[model samples]
Target chain A: MNKYRIVIEPGSENSNYWKDLWNYRGLFYFLAWRDILVRYKQTVIGILWSVLRPLITIVVFTIVFNKLGNFPSDSGAPYAIMVCAGMLPWQFFSSAFSEAANSLIANSNLLTKVYFPRLIVPASTVIVSIIDFLISFVILIGLFFFYHFIPDWRILFLPLFLLLATLTAMGFGLFIAALNVQYRDFRYVIPFIVQFGLYISPIGFSSTIIYNNANIPDYLKFIYALNPMVGVIDGFRWCILGGSSHLHIPQFIASVGISILFLFIGIWYFRKMEKSFADVI
Target chain B: MRNPIITVENISKSYILKHQNNERYTALRDVITNTAKSIFTKQTIINNSKEEFWALKDISFEINQGDRVGIIGRNGAGKSTLLKVLSRIVAPTKGRITIDGRIASLLEVGTGFHPELSGRENIFLNGSILGMSKKEIKNKFDEIVDFSGVEKFLDTPVKRYSSGMYVRLAFAVAAHLEPEILIVDEVLAVGDAEFQKKCLGKMKDVSSEGRTVLFVSHNMGAISALCSTSIILNKGKIEFNGSVDKAVKIYHNIQTTNKNQVYTSQGINKEIFISETYLKNSENENTLAFSHDEPVYVVIKFYANILLDDLLLSISVSDFEDRKIFSSEVLISKVLSVDKKFGEAILEIPSVFLIPNDYKLNVGIHIPNLQVFDFIENICSFSIVDNGSEFSKYVGTDIGCVFSQSKWAII
Candidate 1:
């Protein structure tokens, strides 16, 4: 009996897996298309549901938060525009999180039975969510015209902000997806995290509320920006609204640092959990 | 002719079976007691016993270009683990493996086929998964659809296809993938008989084109027909790695010897226990012997705890790989009288059906729709040595499950 054992070794950052991902890029497109098709399959309105979902969210938030709670918006931008801008990143993150968390378990048939780069699973979810983000962007443009808000040169940073939000979502999404393969409890915890994340992030209210309150110190303001979405939402508001709520340099720096930190940590944790995925999943 | 396509060294893999502890937080009282115990003794308070299982154990083999090798093993014998390590789906715990060419694996049918996608779309999707380029897949698109026989359903979503159609399309894409090396598991078990025959033919065509093939299957008949060499694995270790006939013989011997001690009966009425079973030559020669296209007989002795009625004698014949060749049940309701006394019964297998190969016999005594009285599975094993029969020429080698004598005239 030859006692051969496979010791757990950490994967190097420069392994061929990245190159494999590149080679399997066509698979990424196919899976993204499949996700889009499956999402609208057999529905009465089909692709309209993609635009209608976020549009309905904007209307409900405007009524409940703006009309009743009296939530303050940016200086000149209407409440609908502010909510739509905030909703963009929020929807992208939540949708990406839910999709990626279920990616491995949903594709257990493939994972257990086949040999492909496992990273393709979560990577495809991020791609699929980007399609949804683009569809919902039409409503954002509609609100932009209705509110009569003019763009600034800072609007060029919209792609940068979208990339940051994508990285953050994929970072956490990959880790949670791998963990959910073993500990099924993460499946139940993910929806709660997404819903709770909406209230904690400055989606419904403006980040200016944190600045105007005197009870908090200036140092705490820098710490508050550690939540990566604060800078993203602020950047979106700053870019789209073109108002006094400009990007705070410290908050932006904090956001960039935290986003990178999540990206690295998420990859590390996900790679650690990947070894057991084929068996347990 | 070319460089060795797959060079697998001493590769091994181990898996942790269970988690030891899952508690996130410990009580203060429990922590203080554990801390005191740890201070007094080197042993920890928590008894964490981890069980590690090595799925593959120091297996080393090399496959050359154009070589078709069949890997045969029972379940949990590390066959899939070895393939996974070679394909880089799972890293080997110890040792190393190097391959010189692109490898495509059909470990399971419909592996990357998204049900929501159309069959035409899934063809490109599965092709790319096997590492074929878009242009290559497009060039072979019509051929794939024609081979799968799903041209009418090309635009229909694959989720709507029956399992047979799905497997046909999936296998077509994988079989047509023009990789330098092809690895396939027991995916042939899913398709219908005709489709399975088509897959076997395609595999033969692939291997004949100077491409390497690594096949894993329990069907010894298929392995013997298709592969030039074969390896047999047992308990995560290679038991035999040589000629397909020799490997099949070793596998069958081990299987029969292992099952000789267990007895089980089901779906019969009478209460009886099969005391023992054995096979001998027809002349009472005392040694297991039979010739190709000759009658083979088995003798079963047993004692009945209670008398029974409507007794039926059933026997299942399987090849060296434990794949069932044929089965028959002898109902004694009309042909013969039921003997209520403790005695022996002899079953005879007629000639010219089973090909020249090793086989095992499973015998059972059952009543009509009541319960099994006495049953012995794999009770006796025998081998049919070939003697230059006419059917041997069509098989190319004495390597098929059935040997039927028929003449073909090209009129």
Candidate 2:
């Protein structure tokens, strides 16, 4: 008798999930590349859309917040450079979330007809979004040269912030994607969440604006820092602008903790609901 | 002499179906009212009115290393659900299935192909979906394209290929990406007859190489030709698990007996009514038994109170599970010849084409020209059974369905 048995037990989630995913790594790459090709194909502007999207947002934010609201920029650094830094990570998170939320529903044909790791669907969407992030990062570098801003040694922490943003985006993306499969109303809710989230996160202004305005209570500021994006945006500006807006240890810890929490909850909720995806989708 | 390669123990799957008629909201107001009601009274809070159905109930079977197994059943009999569980696409509500070797399934043709991607790219994409490594897919790329006969269209996106070309390519990719066990579910029905034959030959070759094959199809001819052993599924349970010939016989017998009954239904608006429908042999009497060369007639009797225009009568011949094998439709004005007070339509099917196995007839009435009448769906069914004939010579006893009569000369 063969020692290894591939048994499918109903109503029981497989314990060896990591092994199964490792085996399906090829599918992950296929889906990711497929997404990349489909998005770029037949478009007049082609890959420029990736850069143009974030650059346009940076322009709108720079005008509205810096000129109208009189928000402070990182000391001596141009407002465009400061906003572009925040927009890069924020665009990565929002695009990843939107695409991941719709991944399973969009691939209903593949899910119902074939068997591979269901996680590969959402995971591949995140990877596709990462490709878009790399494309848009080039635009960020151009803005850095135009503004003549030089980064400090703290810029070494950029990779940590990128990882933090990716994890946070994936966590939320998995949760919403799983929910959208069941409720379908999540499709409508996602755009609103992305739009609403843009205002709350420090994209156009530095966190110092909120702190210098003393009308807000101290405890409220502490709770506001718990939003996770607060720490991420502040950290990006500190690292890129080369200023005293150093990494705040407590807020960074809170952001990392919340990201991990969301990741665990997302995976659990996704696995629980995955069984019904084929039937309903 | 070999140990079993696949073992299934008491596997069962149940599905919950939410009734569409019941409208319950999960809104805050509704939740609050329901909570208040539950707090005030000693009663269950939620309504458990949705129906639960067991798709597979306590089914168990085993297949040896080199065995070719066929699963046959009527629609809703859980054949596809069983395959889904076996492929690990969906988990069963209960029971377990264990297989020793790598299993590749072609549950549906072109399962992972992107319409925008060229056939060449899709081959690699689909190969990976079937669990082939990149190097393995590269090695077999030429053979896959040759077998599918889509080498010229390899650079064209699959969406541009004709449906026949699409299925041929999809099946070719699946067949060449060799796995220890192969599971195919009724995919052969999509392609032309010659491609289907090639697919059947490939499946036979695979089984002969000491690999296991699990096939689910309504085509009894294909099943009998390829499978050494067969199982009959009836309403989510295994009815018979034995030699291919015996299981096919049981399946045909069940279909024949069930199709002999007449069907009729009445509605408030009596624009049309289904009176009687049945299947009969050439003797012009309703019977389940049929001869090899005899004509199988589908007789339908219907009534229309007012003078009807553009009324269409359609008939389909399907296997036990309602998968359409062949269908035809006739307009009333074209076939009626004269306006009649009452109507009877008969569809004749010539034999020698359908392999000897159980078959069902589905009758439909529609008003394609008028657009005013409610389309009557498959209103009735009947069966055909084949008598002993020489057409069965090339076929083994295990083979089911029609054996095409073709002559071969040593040229």
Candidate 3:
């Protein structure tokens, strides 16, 4: 007789979960592919929307903050370039986070009808963000050419910063996705988070403005670093706008530590709530 | 003997059914306010009602290799819950299920098909969602399209396809899946009758290849045709587990309505009233169970305070779903003189006319298209058992409820 392939009992889902995730990688890829395909299906703009959204944001922020407000670009990089650097990572974080937050409820039909790692649903939404990020990265390359700004060896670390932004988004996205399944109020809560997150994060202005100020206290700076995206935006500017955009190693470490902690917390809470998702959903 | 392919031991699942409100979702405000009320008031909230309803309780069963098992039950009987547990869609609240081979369950068809995706894209997307690897779907791609007969529309988005074509494409992809064990829950209920028959035929082909199949459906015809062994669930517990015939028999017994088996009319004032009604076999013995080859009679006895004329006595037989199968009527004046105060009517349903299923009998004596003198619906019920008929030799052949021997010559 063949050996027993699967033994299912209460909490058996925890055992071999990572291995099951590995086995179901095809589903992960297909789910991501499905979202990517459906994202731009009927729209005439199609993939161009990915490029246009961030470009328009960069143009509008440059006018409001750089041209009108006359904010000093201490990095010696063009004010528009500095804002573009911050805006790219911020766009990726906001969209990926929001998408991941609603991923579970959006795929509730699959949750009830099929059995695969529930983690795949939210994780796949991140791929959509990655594709959008790659598309919008083209605009930043265009800015580099227009400004004749030659990048240095430090630019090789851009992927590491992108990875940071992804981890940060996924951490909060998974937590919010699971919570949204039980309490639909989280649905209303997500747009508010994305909206409020844009202003608080150092997107329109530089983190250096606050860190360089003599009036702001150290404790306030530390609390600002607690927002994981603050580290991601700082990292992006350090890599892309590399003149005077200093990477604060101490604050960077603090932010990275919090992002990892949120990732674990998100996974822990997601697994805890995953068992009842099919039933409740 | 081959080892059991699936061993389920004491598996159970329960859900906390909240009766506080009809809302399916919780709001943060409600949770916060309820917490505040509970913490400060120090008294239990009257409106907070939580009841744990066990959908499956201490159920245990083992299925061997190459067995086609049908799970038959009324609604709310936990058949779906049991399938959900076995397939690992939802974990059982207690106990365990050990399976020896790859199992794919179809609680629904087209589970993750995106309407905006083309038919070809959805095939791969849905196949992977059902646990098929990409290479496996690619290998079976042509066969799936051929089976669905929607090859011409492969490039078109599925939203544009007709509903029939959509279901065909979905079911075709599912049929090509080569799992060692397949668990399906009423996915065959979709599509037209011919499509349903085709789906059942494909399922039989799957089981014939020595794959274990667990099927849950309310359609007894499909159940009897496909499954060799069956399990009957009642109120979240296994009521019976045995051959398909006996399982279906027990299922009918469980579904037997709350109406009195031997209906006795109340003394509602009328010119005439049915006093008693029941079913009897060919031997004139009172039996609710009858063989498919034997005649069953509906005996209704009524009392009239005054002589009546031109009374039409009708007996209608309906299947388990309450669909009227056929009705037989006789004019009391033509059969026997209605000048007497007491009269008895026996409607004989001939042998081999009704298939193996539970059927209800509605007896009424009424004027043509006018007032009902004495009428009783679902007065009695009876079942026709399959006792190794010639058609029983073949598996998965659904000869519908009504059958009769008609003269035929095949050259």
Among the numbered candidates, top lDDT falls to: 3
Clashes of each: 6, 6, 1
Q: How much native contact recovery, as a fraction, does model 1 achieve?
A: 0.22
Indicate which candidate wins on DockQ.
3
Model 1 CA RMSD to the hidden true structure, in angstroms = 9.7
| lDDT per residue as tens, model 1, A70-116 | 98888767998899989988999899878998899888877766666
RMSD of each: 9.7, 11.7, 5.4
Q: What TM-score quantifies how close candidate 1 is to the native fold? A: 0.78
Q: Over the stretch A168-209, how does candidate 3's per-residue lDDT look in tens digits?
A: 999999999999999999999999999998988988888888
Runs in model 2 lying further than 4 Å from the true structure: A1-4, B20-46, B258-411
lDDT of 1 by residue, B172-229 (tens): 9988987778889887776776777788889889999988889998766677677888
Assess every candidate by TM-score: 0.78, 0.79, 0.87
Residue-by-residue lDDT tens digits, candidate 2, A1-281: 56456877766667777898998898899889889878887789999999999999899999998888777787768888889888988888898989998899899889888888899999998888888988898877897788776778988988888778888888888999888876667888899989988888888887777766699998877776776677677777777777666666776677678888998999989888887677656
TM-scores, chain A, per candidate: 0.90, 0.95, 0.97
